[model samples]
Target: MEIAENTALVVVDVQKGFEEAGFWGPRNNPGADDNIASLIDEWQSTGRPVVFVRHDSSKPQSPLRPGYVGNDFKDYVEQRRGKGAGRELLITKTVNSAFLGTPDLAAWLGAQGIAQVVLAGIQTNMCVETTARMGGNLGFDVLVAYDATYTFDLEGPFGWRRTADELARASAVSLHGGGFARVLTTREIVDAAG
Candidate 1:
């Protein structure tokens, strides 16, 4: 449960579109903000790098399309901008995976000699899982903040409507059990950062 100083917190796609009242927003994960906000503050206090990934949908019908009010980050993230607080690295990606078709995040981490990544953000089974797997494959120890990420329910092949909580469950099982990453709670992360 110890978070090393060389660890970087990678917050993936915590945009306003995910927090707003809509189909894409998280309805099952009720306290996602509380978890993510606490981790942000903890990482800031520890002087660790906090990397933010934003999904910019180029499609006209995409939720993060240009000029959309819900395309920006939420209030918790907006209030901390330009304050010169933490080692904040903001990058925007257009794909479901942050590592694919984007700037060199791995190179940036390599330049800083960061060997571990703590991931937290939206779409647990999508972007967060993808980034965590990539980070692990790239030789970085990956830590996934379980409660800090959110995703909407999805329809599967069967007659089952999968919920966000269910998606989160599958993500933890796949990422952690599959050896892609270690899943932890926000409180454990804060305690480790201390």
Candidate 2:
């Protein structure tokens, strides 16, 4: 698929808090960070719009809560943001969807005349998936870079544990099958961008 020049890359919740493996349990897609970095590089080099979404958890004990070290963006992401300052947009949110964040993602995209969005980031089944669904519903062409997002294992209500890989795969299936977004690998997105 050809990626339009106006497509915005929306990266969600790629914070240091996710490094706490014990807190979030084991995660899948160890190469997610590298893939995300590659996407960021491609977008920046191509002068495409880039939006970074940060999750400032409202829960008191959450690692991503305000004032915590974990609330900071990961080192590499921070560096890229600093280097691309003024050209990139940062959306601070306490929720799952970036579109629901501060400054209004949909409005900003609309103002820029952007009708397509590419999503990447942490918690594949949560923030990334939610943003993709909302973007699609809002009449935007949403593309999810599945390999650039990762999720942790979780225990269900019935005490059944689901692996991180399983959760990530399920999210991709849901997003693509439900018509919320097109799910593609980071490589596919990057190649198409070129």
Best-fitting candidate, measured by lDDT?
2
> Cα lDDT of all candidates, in order?
0.81, 0.92
Which parts of model 2 have CA positions greater than 4 angstroms off? Answer: none
**lDDT score at residue 191, model 1, on the 0-100 scale:** 84
Distance from true location, Cα of 153 in model 1, Å:
0.7
Q: Which ten residues in a row have the lowest lDDT in candidate 2?
A: 81-90
TM-score per prediction, in order, is 0.92, 0.97
| lDDT (tens digit, per residue) of candidate 2 on 31-99 | 999999999999988888899999999999898998999999999999898454225789999999998
Model 1 pairs whose backbones collide: none
TM-score of 1: 0.92
Tally clashing residue pairs in candidate 1: 0
